[model samples]
Target: MKKPGRLLGSVSAAAFAILASSPALASGTLAGSTITNTVTVNYQVGSVAQTATSASNSFKVDRKVNVTVAETGSATTQVSPGQTAAVTTFTVTNLSNAALDFALVAAQQSGGTAAHSGTDNFDVTNVKIYVDTNNNGSYDPGTDLEVSYLDEVAADASKTVFVVADIPLSLSTGSVAGVTLTATGREGGTAGSQGAALVETTGADSANTVDTVFADGAGSSDSARDAAYSAKDDYTVLAAALTIVKSSKVISDPLNGTTNPKAIPGATIEYCISVANAAGGAGASNVAISDPLPVTVTYDSGYGIFLNGTVTSGVCNADGAAGGSYSSGTVSGTLSSVAAGATKTMRFRAVIN
Candidate 1:
């Protein structure tokens, strides 16, 4: 259970002396660099200067493997249904004493608590991972290179990553999809190609070579000292939700007029269709309604039609414009727009043939 950074028995206590000296750098000392300390003893023998004696001790600095993955934004990413290429950003920082490569992975939560303050109710499609090659802190489709791993990131440096995915059209408002980003540490020394996976040095440390240590802390999803870290982000749907309702009533009859009219052969009937959008949702545009006349009913040309009316107390008001038309035994009308939490209705009169 001993940690990796400890000075092992490869060098005796008497041989390597502990000192307050080491190669210092702003970021950190190089992994394999040697640190040597020498002490010289000067004395006088019988009031005469004697030959000076000196002893030197040296050891290689061990490699410390550490990394951190953090989600960039403070809140969940807001997205709409059927949205494409929605991006969630993260930052991967190398905290090790040496440059390293990091393998990237983006995963989705099946169904559970999301990274934010809501429950994950759905999963996004076409998920992909990309690196910010230009370091612009934003994702550009063709400009930012899509990558599976980061190459040779220097010590104490950070790189930006993006997780892009498509939102399914079936999602509803307030639905959430959670995603996690993980980066695993890897060996780094070559110029272009990715290095092999990193393994912790076990048992005694070699006297001459540098030992590897996993010193990273636990992240949102990964365990501590595992040479990997993870962070979570989520997307919430904010699309319009529309609902339609149609109602009809017997207005009058050829014999009774407006007095207790029955569904006689010459009865007059009125139809009202209401379209409503849920609150806190996006506005709906170009809303159109169509109703075809039944075999036993005929459109009343004298009464005409009403479009873009209002609904109150579950009843359609006649305060709409005369814009609807009847063609081929069908009534059709179009509303310019419907705001959120608002309802627009279409009304028309027909005769019972």
Candidate 2:
């Protein structure tokens, strides 16, 4: 007896070829989706055609969880001792396809070779983290939500958080502190309990089955699908120091003349004012120095006050000719900027009344 001429094999091969060539039968779907497939068989028996349909095969796409973090504000902020620095904002986004919660933690690192890197010799006090509830991209006290960890964030959604800290009074000038914020995915419920998985069904009344198609290569459940991410910011302390000193010397006396001048009536006394800035401190801006003539003395209109021994019209020129000016009983000057370890002097003469 002759064999069946491989009719069944030929039919199976033809069906597979048709399935492979048809674009409508492609095999990929988005995460958290379901794929259903069915096939029909057709054959001819002695010129009589017959058809039969096969059962449907369905597949569920597993969930994929991922997160990203970024610092939203200026990369670096300047602050003074005992001052509150500008808030550093961070945005955490859930790149996953399912809703999930995240646990947030902050850390401070000191001294590295990179730019803005220095030993954080001091600690910033009263540091607090808050959520930007109003979505204004800023940290507003008494208005924005404050939470220890991030609450439920929808897939492809983001949440903004803030880090507000104070520069301790004891922190030295030029000291720097680096802050890093980290976000980790939180597994739901008690130990060994798989958190809510991405459901294949939509709306209410959906089943709780896991979508194995998108499952992680490790085969872990949805709760273990997500991963962590982090970002960083820096703070530098600004310390400005200013000091002033006054000195006086007798220029001349009507009775004793210029040599061995006395403080008697009709004697001329010279006054000097010295201003200095501490070393390694931030430059002082718009500095104004003023001195009032002693009540016991009179202003000598003919005498010129010298600024760093120049600009002799009662105005000091240490910063520039326009740096110093004087009126009837008082002398004042504005210095555009005074750098660290720099000093300027002002001198004027007054005669005893």
Candidate 3:
């Protein structure tokens, strides 16, 4: 047969030059995986030698979408303007191999200028986002998983998300706010469906060598493969503004001296107490400040109980010398720090016995 028709056209031109110089075995496998190849052919009938084998087709890899976001805790937290700020966890991972559906959004960031400048603009109230469900990363309101988005993850699986916010009592006291959390990739619609398509680039093509399943670059919207993810956190607000004042003076008056003062039975009063702080506010740690002993007066202990006038009745300082503490009738003090507009004073001496 003309030497088997030139030996089948020299085995089809050597299998098209070994598949055009081995382009990675005809690229195509990963994603949903499947690749099988086999080929063999030898000829020499004149010498009674021949062999031919080839039959094995399988190459199907398509379906790739990725996602990853993290900020699981303590990215910076501390709040009290209306309270309720301590839950900014996030996990959302599904480096997709298949089975995907995610969509969740939350934003509240402003022109920040660092440390209490314009206070970084503010707006945080009620905001909530949940899905931890027993994975025990915390936030168990009714046994976890309260989805507003994100239904199926499986395929590298991972989902912890939680945002819970509320710091707006008029926010101000070193005010600061920034919170962003986004995760999108709702391929075929289902959870709150809205015609999803943040990913899934149509089998992604690079000349489609049998569909090589996006190694990044198909219809690539590139969010690391369109699974998309974003995360940011920060909330700071700590307020403190205090003020108190009380006064009385008419020292020594056996009956009525120091300008017609008469508390009867050997009078002698001198009670003052002032404690102020409120400039930019926020700075009043451990500051005690107590006072109680007025059954009509009768505490003198040699004219004791003085802080700024310093009789050393129990230490309290602000140039008032010593830190603070008094006993019995109570006249406590402990101003570890009170700056902001600063002011501290406490004096004592009474008798109407």
Q: What are the models' TM-scores? A: 0.78, 0.60, 0.38
Residue 275 lDDT, candidate 3, scale 0-100? 69
TM-score of candidate 3 on Cα atoms, chains taken together: 0.38
Candidate with best lDDT: 1
Q: Could you give candidate 3's per-residue lDDT for residues 49-72 as a string of tens digits? A: 777644433344566666666776
Which parts of model 2 have CA positions greater than 4 angstroms off? 1-33, 39-49, 110-116, 187-208, 211-226, 241-247, 254-270, 278-281, 285-353
Q: Point out the higher-scoring one by lDDT: 1 or 2.
A: 1
lDDT leaderboard ranking: 1, 2, 3
- Candidate order by TM-score, decreasing, is 1, 2, 3
lDDT of 2 at 252: 96
For residues 62-104, what per-residue lDDT tens digits would candidate 1 score against the true structure? Answer: 8999899999979999998899999999999999999999999
The backbone clash count of each candidate, in order, is 0, 2, 5
User: TM-score: which candidate is best?
Assistant: 1
Span of ten consecutive residues with least summed lDDT in model 3: 1-10
